[model samples]
Target: MPLVDKLLILAIGAQVFLAIAILVLMGRERVPRVMSGEIPVADIAVERSGYPLKARLLSNSFDNQFQLPVLFFVGALLLLQLGFVSWVDVLLAWLFVALRIAHAAIHVTSNDVPRRFAAYSAGLAVLTLFWLWLLIRILLVPSA
Candidate 1:
């Protein structure tokens, strides 16, 4: 498989793992709160602490994975289908994945807005470039 394909798979895997982690975090906090009668139910409502800070952060991070990253997934698949794999595309795809991971880390750990924004912006830029490169390749290369 091409490096871009591998990276795309890994990025999808990261989203799945992050979702599981978010569920675990929610259970960890909600179970205890409910058992101790602090919260009447295992609900993530604004009234009941709103899923704790960490859980909320992880949930938000998980949500972000589904947004712009969808473009990366579609771009990679389009490149594969078009038989236009290149090192430049692979590198950009990997860069986007790394930046997204960094963004999630900053978001879930310190919840620092500026740091997370920097990472998110970098990832979005890479993804945009990847799509542009794909367009260029498709327009210039003749079909097989």
Candidate 2:
């Protein structure tokens, strides 16, 4: 496997860890109530709190991170088969993974919406670029 593939696997592991943390945090009666059902009266008035805001942010970050790896994995495999893998693809894959980690840290620690949004935008841009790169590369090259 290429280094990019290894990095993607690491991203998967990070995502799984975050997902488990989210599940544990959300299992709490207070958080689960807000997430699943109607807001309890105490929650409405007092604002039920658990796991802090950072955990929630991490949860969202993980969710976003989970989708990109799956897409990138497919793209990588297709590109590999085509014998057209490029440094750009690997760079973009790593960029997306790095941004996701930063996003999660910012979300969980400082709850910085602007920073999170910026990271998310960057990740999305990388994804778009990767898709375009793959499509153009495959289309422009003759089939074997």
Candidate 3:
């Protein structure tokens, strides 16, 4: 494997870790409430009046794992699949991962909308750049 490929894998690994952290947080926050009859089981399927703020934050963070992060996974895999590897790709991948982590941290901790949005927006930009860079490379460089 090339160094760029390894870097992408590591960045993806960081994303997986963030997902696991959110899962664990959800478990810690939800389990106690559910067991204590504070949060009803049926309400777990969606955000509702019965849902507490901490649980909602964790749930939202977890849901976000399937959102923009999907683009990250696809972009990383596509880069590797088509052999478009470079330091720029690696840097942008890491930047996306970092911003995502920041978003999650703000979400689950303070639930700060502005800070979280900034992180998420920056992450989306990084993801877009990654995709655009890959597309340009694919169009310009003929595969040998």
Candidate number of the best TM-score? 3
Candidate 2 runs further than 4 Å off? 1-52
Instruction: Please report how far candidate 3 places residue 140 from its true position, in Å.
Output: 1.2
Q: Put down candidate 3 lDDT per residue, 44-106, tens digits, no spaces.
A: 756545678887888889999999999999989998898788999999999999999999999
Residue 30 in candidate 1, Cα distance off native in Å: 4.5
Give the TM-score ranking, best first.
3, 1, 2
**Ranking of all predicted structures according to lDDT, beginning with the best and ending with the worst:** 3, 1, 2
lDDT of candidate 3 vs native?
0.90
TM-score of each: 0.78, 0.62, 0.91
Q: List, residue by residue over 35-94, the lDDT tens digit for candidate 2.
A: 665565454454434334544554555566467656766776677676666667777766
Candidate 1 residues lying further than 4 Å off, grouped into runs, are 1-37, 42-49
Give residue 20's error in model 2 in angstroms: 6.8
Residue 140 of model 1, lDDT score? 87
